[model samples]
Target: MKIAKLAFGLICLAILASNVVTMSRWSEARGVYDDICYLRQAHLFQRLGLGGLNTNAALDYDGYFEGKMKQIAFAEWQDPIRWPCHNPMPSGKDVMQYPPGTGFLLALFPEGHQVAPLYIAASLIVCGLALSGIAMARTLPSLVGAGLFGALAVYLMINPAKASYSVAPTMAVCAVAGFLTALWLTREKRSVLLIALIGLLLGASVNFRLPNALLAAGYAIYLAVAFLRMRTLSAFAQGLGFAAAVLVGMAPTLLAQAVNAGSPLATTYGSADVVAPAFDLAVLGQYVRDMQFVLIVLAIGSTAWLLRVGQGSVRQVALVVAGNLVVNLGFFLSHPIFTPYYIVPIAMLSLWSTSFARLMQPEQVRQAASLGREPTSLGVPSR
Candidate 1:
């Protein structure tokens, strides 16, 4: 068992490094290409002084995205070419249509990296890798659970994408961060402060991609169930704090989307581009196939856990899994644009299962430890 654990861990490490190196090697001449479009969307915020996109800039596409080295990482909206809107756009609506999260990230890119998202994308992926690593190390058991969990996390985090700019890296970061947040927030001595902080983190993630609203829904359910179980007014106050922090994090994009997109929820790409009206049974199968091992393990584990036995944070893990899966499944069922990247939250939450499961006994253990009365007769030291 020890040998197998060592071998498994080493393999996971190699896979992790290989994926990281590949991502590190991307450059402008190679990968950035159109990915920087999000960055330019962010730049519009800076150039136009926090107002909506310039109408003429988007409609008049003359020399807007041009330069030597072809370093034009920008877009002047001609028209938002999404479902329900077919005419050539006469306004700048499309330019500022996307959520400001990715754009805000791009705005932080160095002058050189902006035209190419390679470095930025790689950095975000690395951040995700680091967080997932910490999550597994802190939560999972021994060389097997932790090793397999880390391997699964890296595999999900490193999948190829159309651009690391919007879909890939942003979602990956949010998932990794969200998973870690859940682990911390669900600790035995959970507090209103902790709940608010969790709310703040998950709420902010929603503005990154509108579909992340699904994640928000799941989190809201978890919080609701948790507080309801406690049945206290302070628990409700925690909810308010979470709401305030979310508004703080999303102030820029939320306002911009409302004013520029005409519909606060409408993105630059528009709703039609985000979701397909053609709902089919096959899309569900595609999600299953795309998520691969992660979803399979989750499905199997969930059936057993839900039907047979589980409680405490174990049940919380189930909630996270069910919440993310149910919401995303409904969204992706008809979302023609749904890609593997869209499943980051699902994969991430799935990988986090062990961590949450580890929290099975909270209050009694915490109280015992705090009073310096830990049981040592069995010597089965708890992690």
Candidate 2:
């Protein structure tokens, strides 16, 4: 078993090294409109600090946005109103439509050399998580499963993730959140603090991609159901704590919306993105032929497998994952648009949570079953 584990660990390391090399060769000016917009946001933060949240086109006095647009041969490069991702507001201000998180991450590196380092760093963190998952496996089959999944997760950093700058950091968050979800669900005693931390992580994800807010659907549904059934002050408090933490985590995006859109509840996105939800066969067809469908199938199969064989907290974790998959998939499938990376976050989160739950089952089965039971206080299992 040790020998197999060693071999898999080395394979993961090799994959990580290859990912680093690939990332290093990436060019920041890839002629993508989104990349230029994200870099402009980073330039704003670097220049204006917190004041960068107000992403008005007037801030581009130094011609940073113009330079990027011209590099792509944009016909209207001289006009801010003609920018690809910037939305014109009723306030007569054209603002970048993306959330501030990815730009903030890019700003951490020096100008003109940000994309490579950001992706390389994200790949390293994901590789580390994969290795840790491998280490936690107690049996041969589990070890191999973790090793394979980890390798694939690391390799994906360059494909669909590279298609959008926001996806890089979002992938890292999903990896960490999946592990934490398993840990919180399988513990003998429920911890409010743990759930709050998970909420904060999901909330922070919104800063990267606005749609990531849907990632909390499963957690919210599970907690709400738990509280309603138990009807205890502790259960209520637990749910409340988680909700508050999410709001706190989303503070930056909210502030940006308020500053740019005239209200926090309002969106800075253009009309095309604000349309009503309706099932589109073309969009559905795109997912059916894409890699995301394969992942969704895997997530469903894994959740069903866990429910069939798992006991106590393991079953609870499976239920949460199942609900999350249903909600997120429903939204993306019905929407009028389709993207390669649109469903990746939910798929990865469900996969990671289930993978970790399987690895921890031996210990989790020994713990007392507390989920859906009456708690003593603060939602902690009564000893």
Candidate 3:
């Protein structure tokens, strides 16, 4: 299955255009899920600086109500919903909680931040979508394969049932990119630099959504199994290097957590309120009724992938997919509040894994690099 670069470019553009229009319309109206709060934090970013979302810097601009100020504030949806100051003003219920990844993107504009930076946010999301699209085409050889992959990605974003999580297209795209990055990183031998890069990528995802820390499990397991299989000291060194890099990558988010939640490992939502009983019948029942289609499709597709990619060059891909599913199910089963958007990132990651299996058919074909060649040599016995 081969998609010409031109046709692939057109498809990417179409996806971006659709997302921009949908997000623009949503930005005009009140959204059900949280977005304004992160955009508000972004308004304070330049002045407050990096990792300052939880700091008291916003207090410096309190009551600065000139028309220009009001316009900018209105544009960025800057509410008093931030961590309250000592004077204790009644705040917007919404607060900026996660790392500043999305906030930093939106805060690039100085004035007229515009009912959130829908354009900037949309652009970045579309950019990731394009990156994933290209990666899909490269992994799969045919245009048909690329078209199918694009349809899957677009459907995750456009499906009506998944719309509640539309506030976070960035996370979905990031999940796809993270999957692709893992596939590329593990396609051959690991180096200190490449291992560090993997850490950086996973860390970026964690900063976006803390639970993504689970994605690391797949990598770790793959490393462990590879070391045992090869029984080499270099493999052990590679594993250690990758672990160190993951810590380095996680540092910024940890710093932000310390500032916001007073603990590097804790989230702003760490209170008992959001925790739910394990295997909660009510939440399970709700999900079964509302999310049955998504659950069934992902589970079936992933199972098929597991069967097709049996312990070959794409083992890491399967591990990553399983990790994503575990994290998603873990959260859904345990969380007091599980929304439709919460499952989107997981779905996207699963799609990436499934596509990898489809393209490489790891059960039948392990495309390994030959000496001085470009790695597409299937059944070369080099992996």
TM-score of each model, in listed order? 0.71, 0.95, 0.71
Off by over 4 Å in 2: 362-383
lDDT (10s digit) by residue, model 2, range 125-165: 89999999899888788899999999889988988899999
- lDDT by residue (124-222, candidate 1, tens digit) is 564444344444343324335555655655554455443345555444545454455445444654456655665565556665676665655666665
Candidate 3 local lDDT, 208-277, one digit each (tens): 5666666566667767777898888877887887788777766777886666656787556524334645
Per-candidate local distance difference test: 0.51, 0.88, 0.53
The candidate 2 region of ten consecutive residues with least summed lDDT is 374-383
Note the clash tally of each candidate: 6, 0, 7
* Model 3 ranges with Cα > 4 A deviation: 1-12, 28-33, 56-61, 64-96, 110-142, 158-182, 228-231, 270-277, 291-296, 309-311, 357-383
State residue 206's C-alpha deviation in candidate 1, in Å.
2.9
Cα RMSD (Å) per model?
6.5, 3.4, 6.5
Q: Best candidate, lDDT-wise?
A: 2
For model 1, what is the error of residue 139's alpha carbon versus the real structure, in angstroms, after optimal superposition?
Answer: 11
Q: List the candidates ranked by TM-score, beginning with the highest.
A: 2, 3, 1
When summed lDDT is taken over every stretch of 10 residues in candidate 3, the lowest stretch is 84-93
Scored by lDDT, model 3 comes in at 0.53
Q: Pick by TM-score: which candidate is best?
A: 2
The candidate, 1 or 2, that scores higher on lDDT is 2
